[model samples]
Target: MPMQAAQWSKALLADALAPVYLLVGEELLVLEAADAIRRRATTLGYAEREVLEAGPQFDWDNLARAAAGMSLFASRRLLDLRLPGGRAGKDGGAAIQAFCADPPPDVSLLITATEWSSKHESAWSKSVDQLGVQVVFQAPRPNEWGRWITARLASHGLSASSEAAALLAERVEGNLLAAAQEVDKLAILHQGGRIDRAEMERLVADSARYDAFKLTDAAFAGDAARALKVLAGLHAEGEELIGLMGWLVNQLQLVLRLASAEDFASQARAERLWPAREQLFRQALRRAPRQHWLGCLARAGRIDRMAKGRESGEPWREAERLIAAMALPRGSLSAP
Candidate 1:
């Protein structure tokens, strides 16, 4: 049976190392889990480690050879296999089963997959699970990010209040790698002191890329092409779809209010919109009616559900459609 990656550390401490260990999950978590295993294996006298990349054109025979070959540097060895897509072809599966059936003495195998799901499991994976250990690491849910950030900050000898952690969580979105980097930076800047929300806001404001906010600005400014580029940039930078949707939803709600308001100037002042943003909304509201923004807001909610895995559509693609709807005049062009 497979285990949660978070439980691996405790399991490692309680039990002896298995002859083979398979780790599959999000890239950062999987890499970190593999690193932890490597560290433990090293301390247990598995002094020599060899890496094998199982790419599309890789020879399946190499696994068998690695198991049969003697280690030159140490009595015990580790075979670190990198299986990028997690699917072992028929020959690769057979080779793995053969090695597991009568594995070489004192040689451990560590297989890692950065992309994994139930569909990626195979006979080879099951064989390893039967004879060894398999751990899966999943990215935290949207609501779990703040707690994760708080714990990570503690690990770095820094403390953050709940609000501060939540702020960082929102800023980093659900990207664990980026969150880790930010925590490291904060540790250095604050020297392990407690981080407040204001400090986090400062960091976020300073680091805020033009792409995130500009995505909305571009859409509001009736530039669908620029919005698409900005959205793609945010995606490339590892910003979670849900995070992008959060701001998009906010903008849509603001537009709805502004569009429906009987007194636009008073409402803008009440909402504390800056002069520039008020002007932008005034221009955007002119291109489309209140009903249009309402429709877009409804679509945004659907996108958010998709982003959170509650719906089936591709959130990114749906987001692109939403941007097109907001940026272009009604009936000017259909969403691609």
Candidate 2:
């Protein structure tokens, strides 16, 4: 039913046998998991990978065209229908349902959605999970972020000393996308396999590329001047305010998770936390209020929606508001 991202074979899973591959989740890892599924399907003679967006404007017949033509390149074909949350809707949903009712028996049907919620149900996600595989790319919590960071670095065939690992984890927290990037940069600077603390501190300490991380650090430290400076610079550098708020939310969540959990091992057990990130989590726990992260999420969500053109907010000003709130001392924020 639920398959680990690593356990599922991309090629085998993408073969012509499985008709529906429903990748469900909003997490970056989940998105990458879908990418893996697609790549594997390529090896199994899946010649086509077309994206069909489902909206009122979309044509039901176009859904069929995703795999309509016979491939001169290969026999097997892949029809990727980017569903409305990977669920069947009015037009394409029914077409997809019909296709599933009596599958093409040749083409592999792949469906992907942002987040799999408990609310909606449709023939598309159902069939995908039943016939195909659901690779979970759940977001790693703050506690687990460290472990994931370690594994990610290890995967790149790189190693960091225990202290360096902890520092990196602290600096990056549990944000995998950011952590992965840091790893990539460190890998580039590392020259060889070994990456030490001075190197990590030197690379991460720079606020140019990773201003948000630095800003959050300043916010936690209650250094308003530093936080504002980073914020203004980040804004100038084309960094979005809502995005920074999102990063703050992520850090806060990790801190709470690590603090509440029985031990640092919870991060590893629950979210695959790394050995080096314990101190960072501990430090975060000490500096910020747990609710600050949640508040940041709510605010960021609204700001993010507005910025996306889905809702309304002066994006730049909203970021200033968030930064102002974040700059407040941990003991300062109160229940609202």
Candidate 3:
């Protein structure tokens, strides 16, 4: 059966051994789950380990060879297969199915992929599910995030109030790795204490690494200073200019769509705007007309070209100009 990372502990305790294991996700949670499996394999006398990374140039026969080979040093072995592209192509699928059908008793197969999609639901994946265990790691939703943070803190022998957990949820912005790291830091700083919002604020002040969403928040709030500040921070942090431009284009398109709608509330619902963020979009709508927003998006497109070397200008400078154009007062537009 397919299980999440949280259910792994109980599931592992109940059924600790399996012929094959498939872990699929892009989050660090997968790493934890894989570590658990590795430890259990070691405990079960799979003392020898071999890793096979499948890539464009990978040979499918190597998988069959590894399974059939015997370890000279150890009686039992662990075959760790890393599929970065998440799919076993035609030959790989056949090889995997063959291995699953008659897995070597001395070898325990551990497979990890960075992602799993509908297209990956091939016979190989099905064979693994039938023969072994599959664990998937999914990110928690916004409302469920506070509880996640609380549980993470409790795991480190630390606890936080509901307000503090909420603050942490906001600071990390749904990044589980960041939340886990922050909990570790808090455990060191304030061990054996119940954390509150003020303490959270002090600890998490510099933790807010600027991202596209934060940049858009400043621009939509009409704070030219903060918007430019965030843009500079992003550039300094080595954020890709093309990704930032994509975010700006997306947000401006949303604004353009909302502006054209007769009922903005209905439009917001259609756009799936979170309740906390709807006010920011509405404020941005009031700040600029549809034409102006379109112009900003057009400028973003030019920046995209510059980033791809299709144009002849500095991309970062162009992005700063676009952000300034969006955040400036209503009468600030002079020319293209």
Candidate 4:
């Protein structure tokens, strides 16, 4: 079985290190997990490190050669293998399986991939799991972001109210690296003081880029005025209609998924929704049927074409109409 990312720290406390370890998933989390593993290996006297970038043209034999050859001065070494796109082709898989079959003494192999899903699993990964450790560092879901931010703030010796954390979560929009940077900035600016929502708003940079995400949230929350205001802001800032439509379409699709489910509570849990976001979706579903969201999504495609010059119409006007249809009550939308 693969180890949970949260359990990795506790596992590192063990006296002995595994011969092979694989860390995969979101880039920031994967990088951080790899860093922790490297630190632990260093402390255990793995004095030498060799990095191998496993790109499409990489020679799989190099892994074996690296295992066989270590610096004369260093008795122990860490082999860092980076799998781009989280795939090891047949040859690469064979090489990894061979390595696991007879892993060299005094050598630790750390494989890190920046992306992964159920499809990424294979025999070689299973081999690593059997011999050592495998971890998937999943990003927090949209609803889980606030809790993650709160925990992260705590790590920086800062305390924030749930509202403040939720605000920060909205600002970052599931970008872990951006969230980390914002938390670091707050720690410096606030000196680890307890922060409120208003203070958080005042302290964080006003990132116009994430307004697209907020646009959908506003619509979901039934704040038509706020949603339209954000849409206008995005338009004035020269944000691409297609870019904005991308997130809008994604969210509408999620709503369709939820609305179509026979069991909403179970589906929400499967989607990893937190209570706040769950409430937002609940209200959205109540206000509009799945067919309504489907219509909006289809309209979004037309806007995409308009933006791309393949269709006739003002994409911005169409986008505003779409937002209004989503944000307003069932009979409240006016013709554009």
Tens-place lDDT per residue, model 2, 243-310, is 66567667666666765676554463476543224423443455665666567557656777777788
Residues 78-148 of candidate 4: C-alpha lDDT, one tens digit per residue: 99999988999999999999999999999989999987999999999999999999999888988889888
Name the lDDT of candidate 4: 0.83
Cα lDDT for residue 67, candidate 4: 93
Off by over 4 Å in 4: 205-336
Provide C-alpha RMSD values for all models, in order.
17.3, 14.2, 14.9, 13.7
Stretches off by above 4 angstroms in model 3 are 14-16, 206-336
The list of candidate 1 runs beyond 4 A from truth reads 207-336
Candidate 3 lDDT tens digits, 1-336: 677677778766743468899999743666557767877877877778888989899999999999999789757888989897889899989988999999998788899986877677788999999998888777788899999899988877888899999998997787665566567557656747788899878766533333566688678768789789888987887877877777788888888899899978669879876433555666678777888888887888888999989999899997888888888747454445
lDDT of 2 at 101: 73
Report, for every candidate in turn, its global Cα lDDT versus the true structure: 0.80, 0.63, 0.79, 0.83
lDDT string for model 1 (150-249, tens) is: 8878877888889999988887667565566567556655745677898777655523343566678779878789788877777777778887788899
Which candidate ranks first by lDDT, i.e. highest? 4
Candidate 3 least-lDDT 10 residues: 204-213
**Count of residue pairs whose backbone atoms collide, per candidate:** 0, 7, 0, 0
- Candidate 3 pairs with clashing backbones: none
10 residues in a row with least lDDT, candidate 2: 274-283
Candidate 2 or 1, higher TM-score: 1
